[model samples]
Target: MTKKTPSLISSEFFEPAKASEQVAPKETALEIVARLEKSLVGRNPANQQSPRPPTRVQIPLWSEDHRPVLHDLVRSALFTCGQRDARMDLKAKPIYALEHIKITYTGEELRQRDYDVYLQILHLSRGATVDNRQEWVEFEARSLIKMLGWTQNSRSLVELRETIRRLTACALEVTRSRTKSSVPVVYGGPLLLKYAGAQEGGFDEVTFWKVQINSEVAAQLKPGDYTRIDWQIRTKLSPLEKWLHAFYSTNQHPYPMKVETIHKLCGSRMAEIKFFRRAIKAALDRLTEVGFLSSWQLDDTDKVKVVRSQMLTIQDRESNNDVRT
Candidate 1:
């Protein structure tokens, strides 16, 4: 039996690195705000706009001691925390909290637009709470929001707002948890310290900063706990999803592979083949939307005749070489 290679590529492949380079590194939140303010003034020069205070949300997190840690002044900035002995690739985790998460233009027209965008930055950091699963769990967004008794909403707008609030709270709780879960400078799982000195410092005071983990402490987590870390949206591959992705990644040879041939190659039944056919068709539709693939509908006759010509070529090559006598 041949082993199948993993087909799921990293999400980084979907994002254009060139687009990131176009953005400036030194641009400040204040500068962006100024530009927006100027544009608003330019559009509405009549000086009839009413002054409304900037909108903000205050989310609360529960510390290990059952005390509420409050981020009194949340702004458009980034925050991060990490395990003391985390692997290089998985060390630092960051969260970006947006200042003007929503825009409410309340005068002649009542329109609200969500502008909240925050990203959690994960990295290796030295902290009292470094490498402690219990502490980290206490700081995760889902768990923290649950602790805060926030209600979940199904609408995208409400979900985005709720997500931002919980994430901000998670950052504070995670950072504080790091201060509480102290692992020793010597790497050991069980002997790892649970509480680091409150005075120990490395995290940045303002937003958009990084924290460091100690060299000695290893993360005290079960293998299963690795899946629960606070990261971006990741989906568990269902069996069908796996097969569809795998088939595309390996068969770089242009399509028109016969459905029967694919079934034989995968050793699948008619029902399974039908499933893959539909899956591939849907995937192709999505790829077309993202400019990755081009496709067209074929008539019944064309569909029945489509075959892998490469397979036919190989069969002919193996069968015989044309001889001119």
Candidate 2:
């Protein structure tokens, strides 16, 4: 008897109506993770990761004469331990007075590695949250280690600090590690004012986290350091990509500009610029489909008109600068 081989089903065989089902959905869990991860890193993860919600934090509450250092530290701890994870999943509600904030995996039969990875994230988060605190700091470290199956009381402030350092760095590293398995796309910078284009509610979730995290972390720092962290967060873009994309999107370079220009203008690492491009292009495509901004090849006169309008804007800016001088 001859063995049989499986043949592929080509699109030619599918009806027009059925083509949509064949196409993969745009939004996915990975996309959510990627977006949040970018926002966290850009927003100063160390500062933004807070325990309490923003609606509750009070700012300028500290008087110049007596700045409460421990309060600042508490604010940072709460924000780091709570806020970043809090905003993503509306289903995840706050439950207080619990010893360990246990994150259970119940939806699917996820691999042990998945649990371990996320557990590591939580462990490191706890370590950072309790950084420099004499009370409950060791306990937080121990609980975090327990979750990771690493049991030994040898953890020191130095060790905890190292853990915090590694964990924050790992957030970026681990993100890259996972990206290899998925389709690679450009990441537009953080959804800041400039790059928002037609995308509404861009960075609202991130901005919400930043504002709340800053106020909370402000309460937890070591006097001078507390102010430094909070102030930096207020001034800097969390992901940095949002500002870069805003720059590119504002300039109507027909078709995407040379990828290198994007990398240079945005000051993004190679991998990040790649993703930024994908995000911008994806957003543009989406906008075009919805009849927001029309995207077309340079061959068309209408497309040339768009480019000309962009050029005029640049010239106007230059002219304004000359006039000011």
**Best TM-score among the predictions, by candidate number:** 1
Which 10 consecutive positions of candidate 2 have the poorest summed lDDT? 188-197
Q: Estimate, for each residue in 119-215, the C-alpha lDDT of model 2 and write its tens digit.
A: 2332223323321221211224444444444434454323333333332222110011112466532211111111111112322211101000122
Instruction: Name the Cα RMSD for model 2.
Output: 29.4
* TM agreement with the true structure for every prediction: 0.19, 0.18
User: Tens digit of lDDT per residue, candidate 1, span 49-69?
Assistant: 677643322222222322110
Candidate 1 accuracy as lDDT: 0.28
- Residue 198, model 2: Cα distance from true site in angstroms: 37
Clashes found in each candidate (C-alpha, N, C closer than 3 A): 28, 34
